[model samples]
Target: MYNIHWEEKALHELEKLDSKVSSRIFKKVESLKEGLHLSDIKRLKNSDYFRLRVGDYRIIFSFEDNTITVWKVGHRNHIYDRI
Candidate 1:
């Protein structure tokens, strides 16, 4: 199982979301600990990072060693813009 680590930016973004939405996103992220078997995961083009979809939100993260570091969290429409 990979350990999860949230960057300051990602945590801030998650906190700005609605409680229900944040909770759902958190659960989905936690599932990554079981490995990327979840169907929503996809690698970003030309980048080492991968994304996990949870409804309209997107989680931008990368895994190295035994850690999954979440770098950003935002709505699908805007997430890619900043990343």
Candidate 2:
């Protein structure tokens, strides 16, 4: 299983979401500990980070040394803007 490390920005974004939505996202992210073979996960083009889609939100993260570091989290429309 991979360890999860949340970056400040990602955590902040997640905190801004509705409780139900945030919990749902958290569960999905936690599920990554099993593996990244889930259908919602995909590698970002021309980038080292991978993205996990959950509902209309997107999680930007990278995995290394058995750790998954979340860099950002936001709505699909704006998640890629600053990445």
Best by lDDT: 1
lDDT of 2 by residue, 1-83 (tens): 89999999899999999998899899999999998889999999999999999999999999999999999988999999989
Off by over 4 Å in 1: none
Error of 2 at 15 (Å): 0.4
Alpha-carbon RMSD to native, per candidate: 0.5, 0.6
Candidate 2 has an lDDT of: 0.95
Residue by residue across 1-71, what tens digits does model 1's lDDT show? 99999999999999999999999999999999989888999999999999999999999999999999999
Q: Model 2: residues >4 Å from true position, as ranges?
A: none
Worst 10 residues of 1 by lDDT: 30-39
Question: Which residue window of length 10 is worst by lDDT in model 2?
Answer: 33-42
Clashing pairs in 1: none
